[model samples]
Target: MHPRPPCRSTHTFTIAGSRVAYDRWSGPGRPVLLLHALLFDRTQWWPLAADLAASCTVVAPDLPGHGESPMWTGCTPEQVAGVLARLVESLGLRRAPVVVGHATSAPLATAFADHFAVHGVVTVDEPVDLAGSGPAAVVAASGVDRVPERFRSFAEPREDPGLVAAYRSWLDRPSTLRPVPHARHPADDLNPPRFTPLSDPESLASRIQYLL
Candidate 1:
């Protein structure tokens, strides 16, 4: 038989005064919200979302300024959380669905945990350093090496520490922020792509499967 197609669809909604676009992949178990790292968009979650759709629903949204989402000037973690909270409501996911974030978005995940009903938070690669209160700390701790060419110019500002601190304050429970470990970067694939959900989906999906 041919490989099974992933049960997925696209949707748009107004949140925080901007229209946001997202992909919803349906399955059978609990729901999950996937947040992409800085400069990346919801599409980064496709491989893992498709895989996980075999067992659960995965909702991946392009945050305020990325993907099909309108350019939301002055975007803040709080504003992002507010938009996501509304998105969850719009999608009618049960209260406290699990949320996952990659790289810089990890703090956004924490911000979601801070403001919305969430069962837990899962992070992939380079979680925001809780002890760190600023951008330098984020950069120092960032294990990522490459940026998709289009995003290179904004990378520095995106890693701003104030931005990191804005959400790190919300990750409360240590147990809730789960990290997916990678032994080494894939040599051939390295631009070096720091976000594993894009660079190493199978490995990332296995970890997410455990959560599901």
Candidate 2:
């Protein structure tokens, strides 16, 4: 078994006029940034972050408007991506660290790879697509239109195939798509899946290692 690392502490950074709060477990080698799904906060990545800290420094931030980070306007994948890009630089990472995004935040992961100089990206429970399907398609895809407007705003991209193509085009870097076993459901926004990191840290960590 890997040695149990110490508990992480929350740190704050300012980006785009917002206070981004994150948890950091200091380790060695390349850093890893964990971005959580909508509604949930950075604490969702605690299990995965702890396991990865055995090999690398892990940073999991509460995306704007999630957890302690507050936002005054509607959130978009591009806006969130910008926040993450700034956070990495604020941490003094000389190179782009490995980025991991889960659920609806998968697009955010791709956005990082598109805009930043990242080593690689790992997307869990979803493929790398900018989701040009728009709000209606997102509801249909999730099998539920009951989600709040805020969730829809960020999770569902505009109905612009050109934008989707643009995002797909920038994926010149390495990326891995790992689906959670038996957790692929349509109503992801209404009913999020069980915490994979906490429930299956070993498998998740192994996949992340594969990406690294």
Candidate 3:
């Protein structure tokens, strides 16, 4: 087995009036851009970014409205995709970097691939059908946010105090959390790993290496 690569130094940058937070584990080559899920940030790729960086430059950007990126008003997948495209151009990527998107961001990645040229695209465990419907529609139709209300309706009989407290804090501070609706049914938002192209870290790294 290959040894794990060392984590590269992290950095942050701003573009389009938004703070584009990223971690540059390596540099000066085809940049692998990672777009995380709505509920997550750029750090989600921590499991694999460094390993990929060893072979090619890796740049994972927290899409606007998530992580350190300033939330934009009326942000849509298409708009998010446009911003990412611009980011690639601004950075002067040597080659169209491969984009790896997770969960909800997968659709945004698809939109990017459809509109912009890229070395390759990898979307992991994303609910593409759900994403294609858009968050607003999901909220309106399901009476909850992005995920259907059925998904988030269950009450925890025994909850971890820490998690409960953290959630409470998140709810108290509206700015801390994205104001998306909850899913009514958990399965509606959850996709099986088998359906995705990259379900595990090894497969994901292989795909990224191929793109690089």
Best by lDDT: 1
Clashes of 1: 2
> How well is each residue in 24-95 modelled by candidate 2, as lDDT tens digits?
888777788888754456766665677788687788888666677765353466667787788778767576
Candidate with the greatest TM-score versus the true structure: 1
Model 1 over residues 1-212: C-alpha lDDT tens digits? 11124477889988446788998887877778888765456766766677788777788888765678866654566778788778877766565567887766766777677777776666656442345345554543334345345334323335544444434543322424334332223341333226566445677777666666
Please estimate how well model 1 matches the true structure, expressed as its whole-model Cα lDDT.
0.63
Clash total of candidate 2: 1
The alpha-carbon lDDT assigned to residue 9 of candidate 3 equals 59
C-alpha RMSD between model 3 and the true structure: 11.3
Of 1 and 2, the candidate ahead on TM-score is 1
Q: Please, what is the whole-model Cα lDDT of each candidate in the order they appear?
A: 0.63, 0.60, 0.53
- Model 2 gets an lDDT of 0.60
CA RMSD per model (angstroms): 7.2, 9.2, 11.3
Candidate 2 vs candidate 3, lDDT winner = 2
- Cα-based lDDT at residue 148, candidate 2: 36
